[model samples]
Target: MRLRSLEGRLTLLLALAALTGALVYIGVTEWPLPQAFAWMQEAMGRHASVFQPSRVDIFVICALVLLPLCWWLGHIVMDPVKRLLRALESAVASYRDGDFSISIALNRRDELGDLIHMHNELGQTLREQRQNLAQRELLLDTVVQNTPVALVLTDAGDRVAYANIAARHLFNEGRTLNGLHFATLIADAPEALRKAIEGTEDALFSVEMDGSEETFHLSQRAFRLQGRPHRLQLFRRMTRELSRQEVAAWKRVIRVVSHELNNSLAPISSLAHSGAELARRGDVQRLPGVFATIGERARHLHGFIDGYARFAKLPAPRIAAIEWKPFLDALALHCRFQLQGNAPSQPGWFDPVQIEQVLINLIKNAHESGSAPEGVTLGLNVVGHELRIEVADRGPGMSEAVLAQALLPFYSTKRSGTGLGLALAREISEAHGGRIALANREDGGLRVTLVLPQSATAS
Candidate 1:
């Protein structure tokens, strides 16, 4: 082995010890034995009874010198090893305590040196990883704290575990919300807000706060955190978004109305001019046809105006218990549809007249959707606490782009479509505290669903 290595050093020490013993033996037995014995006899002459010298005295003397010499040599060889072991032990303890900054700086030209180098690299890697993790956590905290949405995280015990800055400001007036019971935190909240938070479903509710009404959309999720159940609630302010949408809706309405009026009136004006020119030329027979054409356009324009007026002036629904069989029978008179199944035996709560109108408009749309007349179908059923009225057609379904804006007023696919049919249905459904959903069927069709609460009243 190389002399600088640990194994080499131990071998060198053993060789040196053996050599020293050999030299001591040669000097005592061969070079100075007779002289040493004469000196020892003179010094022991005064204590002759206690000092009985023998031929083996040289061996005892050699042992006395060699034992201390061997001990000193062993200490010289093991001191570095002992110190390195101490350093390694300390560094491992520090690592166990989550302190990766501790590193052994001892250098050796052996296996211990390689161990130290590997240990330092591990520490460096751990330190870098910890730093990156801490930075990511800080960035995430910054975003959560500054977001406009209020966020609350509660533990399995229903106690608040985390609340962001917005959540604190919203619920506790800038006070910390950690460790508070979730129910107690919302105890003083508005009835609508309390009900929305306590319920298992997501909801949108308005609260009168600081003399103005603020609307919020509440969403909740349940998940496992560290193998324990937790719930997260997010409240997003939607008042400004809703206000912007309302303004844009009014602008679209005005634009659509102007375009429609010009389309109808321009042709009517040109026809009138033609009729007057013919009169000047003494064309009396053509005058009646011109007037008849003008009447038809006028009637179409009147009907166009009346549809918008009715949509804008829709009354609140007058809810009443009505049987599905009679209502469906009455709706069949206005629009032909194949009822998919037997009507519910249970009576539904809704305004029969308004619902009948909604079904008629839907069935009419299905009939005009390029489907065979027999392919248009209507379905009614009660699901949970809601009543679902579905109108489906086996026609080519709409594209993603069209489906997104289909429920908006003045959005239509047809050349003569007023676009108020689906929009009016949506408005009526919402007025009864319900909603409408549009989906595409798997077999190539569109499904329009009007969902109303079975026990809902006008809202």
Candidate 2:
């Protein structure tokens, strides 16, 4: 056993004293040397009467001889125990001061050494855990502070527990938000928080703050932290996304309404002009020709209206698995008249009817943009998992102003154009989970690329 402090020292001293007493009694009462010496003395003094030693003298001599032997035995027993006690005391002192470097010195293979080894191992583990926790906390703080989106954490009762800097600025306007109720911080927060807390369903919802036109998309999720329920409210600004969607919807509406109005107005305007010209000329014989011109313009205007109507009322695609090679072949056959003598260097791959319409619109736009000798180049390629179909023209690309409003309905750069072809193509591509992008080609031309996902080949 190990010992420490004054109490341990006293106990060790008492134990040593008891051991000394027992050793002294065994030496005096059970020594075989006294019997053997007495027998030798009797034999030597057999013919003469010898003097006998007193009991007191014998006791003193025995005491003097055994004293040193007892001291040596005590030293032998106490020395190792004292060293072990001192080592234990030092170890305990270091542990109390939070220093784990101190270790017990073991001179022999024993249980005490095994215990010290295990204690050191546990200390190492605790130190490592502390470091890891510190790092994780630092990382979490960085994310919470630097993220653009507002983050709020709530307890099981729907009380606000933590709010990040962004969230605080958003709800409290640089004021303190800690300990504030979740309902009080948000303008329409009560209903939103109630929906998250009372409802068991997990969902994403948008909430617009009252008095302010700010919209926030809120996603509620319930989870357990340390066996306690925690609800996280992740807020994202939806003003831009919603605005873009609204603009697109408005464009669609305008395209449909404009087409309908133009259909009626164009025919009426042409007929009225023709009738006035016939009366001014005073030529009854030319009246039929004027009427014919009116009819032709009216038919042309009807065709334009029909095109716009088709774009506005485009039906949802009935998606089907199709062989890309055969589809492209059919598209080429359908557009053979437009292609004339031009053939692509590489084979094209796409859906036939849908892609043909896209190609026709693009080619028609290209034809209107410029004349021959600087003709349009239609290119198709499969890059990675996307099929890129590009219609590039050698004519001057669109100006910045026109480029900006190119896809908007009723926005046209050409004098005699309806400006619905590119918009229709964009709508179709978006419906198919694809995109169409316009850019100026490097060689002073316009490049329109239609990017579509490639269907997987069946095994």
Candidate 3:
């Protein structure tokens, strides 16, 4: 048998031990040891073999020699196993301490060697996993650290657990914010910012620093992290964004007003010149017609200017309980629309004059949309604590691009449209604690819905 294997080496060592023990027993019990002792005694001037060993003495001698020999052979056979156990114990301890770099290498054609190889493979796998985890953590930290939005994470006790670079600069002049009380950190902050942070809702607040005002949007979220409740707050600067939007809105207004004024003034200018020329030529018959035309143009321009004035100075709504039948009947007298559903018997609380004006504009827009008079529909329904009024028409729906800006002031698709119809309606809706929504019908056409709370009051 090959002695390279653990089983083979152990069996060989045991057999060799047995064989040696048997030989020693025979020599001590049956060999010529007693005769040799007697010759030694004659040489030493003794008459008899006085040193002859007994059966028990021979047995003791054999036992002593065999025990030591067997022990030595066992040590040779099992020393590697004992050493392998110690190494494994040490490796396990290292792994428990999160050190996966340690590996064991041993050369042997035995079970112990196979075990060592497996242990090395496990260590390699663990090391690779730890390295990958570290890389992911590094990437995540880099992204969080460099983001422009200020981020702060607070533990359940309201102490700062983590803060990004932007947050540090914002609250503490770029100093680390770990373990600081959140309330105390903002103690020196502006009142608006402090209120926004302490409030239970997301908000936009402005802070003036060194003679410049900066606007910021604050968003907060609460959730569990690492088995403990934590809150995350994000602050995004919006000063430049708001400024850009304000500039764009002013440009749009200027463009629209200039175009309208040019259109009116150019015609009026030409008419005034024609009238003067006719008067100078003593063409009295044509002068009167020219003067009449000029008057009409002036009136049209006056009415256009008046529309903007009313939009800018709209009065607050005087809320009152409104009965549906009388309101719808009055509305029908002003515009053409087919009532789609029965109006709720529940009294609606809003300014009747303002609401009537809003509905008139909506119905007027519906008719102007090129839908047949019968195809224009007005619907009213009470849903929970709100009043919903929908105006739908069987006309071409607005494109996505137009729909996005349709509610904006001075935005229109019509050639002569003032563009204040929908904008005015939206302003009134919000003033009454309501909102407006526009959407396309599934089959065709567009639908505009005005939602107002039933309990609306003057504000």
Candidate 4:
């Protein structure tokens, strides 16, 4: 559009017309006739006996008249057009180069003039709007960069497209976060957030971040940024708060330990005093019964301490491959519950000892759910890159309250239940790159599934 101008086309047409007129005049003079004779002959279809001016004189006369006529007409028309086009071209070039300083002085009171005026006004309006937008964005960026809280903007693809300075420091250790996966930015993406990412629904999420060995509490919300769906995560330092919570937890443990120890020791002390008094007075007949009571109390206390020790001293798993058929056969031979499900063709990777402990806990829980050996079913299947084992039983399912807190340490509903089984199972599952889920079956009973990644089973 900038290369071809209306002024050039009009100028070319006018020059062609002038040249054609001159050529026609020369043809007339060289045809052995003047202009009057040519006109007469054309009208009558015969030569007329009329005296006319010489051809040279006629040529000179036509040249003078036609030259000035063509010049004046072109001056009146193309001069203004050429000026307007020159200004338009220059302004447009500057605009294309991003130099919006365009002031076109097209001094004409015509339609063409109106077009240029409108274009100039539009340019000015656009420039002003851009300036306003820039200032707003500048203020916004300043606020985001200087705030203590971190802000991350993930694009529709769920990659980190934008991160403020605080977010960079908190999530990526002060490194740039562009193009990083959203999951990698935060070590722990909470369960609700995981579901939200799967398109279930938007949810508020709170997760822990152990950044630089200082704990941080991250609060996340789903929101849109610049007309695209994004996630906003805010982080706050929680080192002091976490330290306080840790102290509180230790205090609670001590209190519970003291209570249990006092309960066992109080009766044991009484029994010992009775036995000593019996010894002094030679009451031999009651010695066995009192000593038996003392032995039973001592065993219970030892078991209690052992349970705490087992939970506290869990070792890291040494993952190794195991033959599935042999493993399943051995588990069936040792366990009371009925085994079911298809035998896995591929080997599974996990600590056979640690995983067996987890399986024992699951089987025991299923049996205790009021199910017979035949009523409990142990299932094994491979799902994607993971091995899934499920223990199900036809018994009364757990209540909602019990189901929620059942995974915590020392939380139990049974009279003699130590409550470390499920907690230890959960810890072991996580160590094997797996997880345990407890849910109520649709028909009846509780179903617990252990999902372990197949990568752990790799040779």
Candidate 5:
């Protein structure tokens, strides 16, 4: 029924041919004689009694008049149809060649107008769909390439399907990661990943990887693809985060340690000079006790100085393969002195020796901040590869002024406090590539936390 199709065109052509043949036959066989008879009848009925025209003359005249009229009528009717057919044919050819811009103009209020309208609608729809697809593709490309963090997409089988430039460089050293396995790219991915893919549980993990001597935190998450069982992994590096914390801890240590050393050494020097003056004055009865007191104070001064020196001269780590369980156990045993009196319960997964020192200093500070029976509580935990060691005190928490200067060397709230202990503890943790921070606990206490690297093993 559609006039735009090839079959319709053939039908129109056949109808036009049949009409032309009929017109030709009528003109040749019946038109001339009828015209001649009409002319003779007009003459006889008006002016002449009898009138006859020769057949040859009559035929010639009739043909001269009739042929031109018939041709004019055919031209008027068929010319427009022929032009319309040519336009339609051209449109069809262009459409077949995948060009949708061609439009046929049909001014008549007829079936041809309807055909043109339908064609225009189809072309516009195609153009819109194409434009929409192009825009979506461009957006997707821009987001993937320009984002700062690495992005990797894998199929259900854990085969790499797509990876952004950042991800490719991180895993494959600038090479493409089109067909590698997810397990192969990461050095010994945890079993959590496999469980995530299998839909057993959600996998969210934060791990520390060995980067030279420094540790880098990598946070990972797994998500399922839309309308599919496939999983996707996302990773982000947290090295800068840890670095910022370490720097803050270092500032605290330097401020506290400097204040403590100045306080003790300055007074010790004056006391020694005073004892020498007493001996010169011949105060024999008081001289022995004064000299002995001077010796005792000097020895105490030496011990404080030695502690500060050790704190300042923390050595770089000589890394080796270490079993975590055994390492923590040994570290705890070394902290027995600190844990002896009114210590908090044992914390989880801490390098006991380092943590013990930190706790001893915090406990000592807490004891000095208040009277007896108001000691501190220490807590440690390993939550998702992050070591959180907290030293909380039941005594009054630090004031704004004290908290502000808490990490500075030799800065203490007490008159007799050396202040080197906390500074030393912070420095030791930092040397192990970790951090220490102090804050007021929510339930009215001072809370100090030391965050350290979990492990540096290859897996």
Candidate 6:
């Protein structure tokens, strides 16, 4: 407004220069043509004067006039620059302290206006960034505090710094966790737990608490907080999961036992009453057959119960070195059906008794699958240092649902089965560092494969 800007100052200087040139032209023109011609003639030995203002005098007067104006204009321009610098300093200080609630109120339409707008934008951006950071921290804190997993945080000196709700309850009956040494909290802890805290390994182990035992799955990690190293310990309780599984297993066992006992007891009771009536009517001819039927059922019940006992009480295998061919031959000699398969020529390490028991069960399942003797096949081979013993049967294979639960204890497809044979086979195979899998062959049959680790069989 006061000719203190680029556009105003340029215009002012141009107008002043034009005004000075006009004044000099008028003054010189008014002086006299005759005087100017005389001066020229005198210089050539003749009297003539021609009038023109000398360039030096005009330039000197212009310099004197512009100097004071330039000095005044500099003050006008520099005053605004100094004020802008002060405003910038204040904004910078506010931003340094993480406060961005400021806006330059000036409305000048210049480069300074753009700078003020940029500062406002920067302030808004910084405020948004701070809000985002705070929200993320809040979310993370909520999750960590509310989680069921016990979390204990320790400083670089192994002193406990913080603990969540679960950790407080686990370590000293909900006492304060601050200022306590980490070692004191976990005094005489289990080896597995110690290893977990040291970042060496993870484990599931039990610790004595309140005169009873409690199981915990342990994990650990290291991190930096406020530029200092910290460690975190996580303990997840496993007692609830284990108790649930145990209760479910007991329910299954009771149901199966009740069903098998009922099957035998009902028929035996009916036969006893019928035999009594036959004797009273003097029709003793069927009495002996009734007694015989009762005996058979009782014996069947006994055998069924015995099978379950054997499966539950199977002992650990006593590994021994033996020839695979001779062992299979001995089993075949005593088997109900003909056995087939050329065993590997090498000697193997395993419990001969346990391996034989597993094979006997598989063979029995195969033989009972169908009426054809050729429906069953025995196969033995070494695949990638694994000893595979597979028994395939040409009977109807299991459906998806049935196969899923086939390995469960007391679960069976056959109506008369006790469901112990395959379970016992699985227990023995696993004891020898082996596992069994069941699959339906494409050609319409079920194939059970036993895969034993090389270390369990190789000699």
10 residues in a row with least lDDT, candidate 4? 200-209
Residue 16's lDDT in candidate 2: 75
Off by over 4 Å in 3: 1-141, 155-157, 221-232, 456-459
Over 1-459, each residue of candidate 3 has an lDDT whose tens digit, in order, gives: 666778888888888988998888877776666666767888978655366788899988998999899889988977999988888899999999999988886887777888899999999999999999999999989999999999999999999999999999999999999999999989989999999999877899999977999999999999999899999999999999999989987888788778888888898899999888888898888887778888887898888889888999999989888888999889889999999978777777889999999999998888888888898999988887888899999989889999999999889898888889999999999899899999999988899999998873411
* Candidate 6 residue lDDT tens string, 133-172: 9999999889987899998989999998989888888776
lDDT of 2 at 419: 74
Model 4 C-alpha lDDT per residue in residues 330-437, reported as the tens digit of each score: 777667766675668777888998888888878888888888668889888887888899999988989999999898776778766666889898998988878999
lDDT of 1 by residue, 1-459 (tens): 776788887888889899989888877776676566667877779455444335597688789879999999989987877988898889889989988898888877787788889989999999999999999999999999999999999998999999999999999999999999989888888999999998998999999989999999999999999999999999999999999989998888887788788888998999999999999999989999988988988998899999999999999999999977777778878989998897776789998889889989999999888889989998888888888899999989899999999999988888888889999999999998899989999988999999999873311
In candidate 1, which residue pairs clash? Answer: none
Estimate candidate 4's RMSD in Å: 12.6
Q: Give the Cα-based TM-score of candidate 1 against the true structure.
A: 0.60
Write candidate 2's Cα lDDT for 132-247 as tens digits: 98899999999987787888888777677888888888778867666777765554554664575446554345555665565566666889978999888777777888889789
TM-score of 2: 0.46
The per-prediction CA RMSD against the true structure, in angstroms, equals 9.3, 13.8, 9.3, 12.6, 15.9, 10.0
lDDT score at residue 100, model 3, on the 0-100 scale? 95
Model 2 clashes, total count? 0
TM-scores of all models? 0.60, 0.46, 0.67, 0.54, 0.38, 0.56
The candidate that wins on TM-score is 3
Instruction: Give one clash count per candidate, in the order shown.
Output: 0, 0, 0, 0, 14, 12
The local distance difference test score of each candidate is 0.89, 0.69, 0.89, 0.78, 0.63, 0.79
Clashes of 4: 0
Which is better, 4 or 5, measured by lDDT?
4
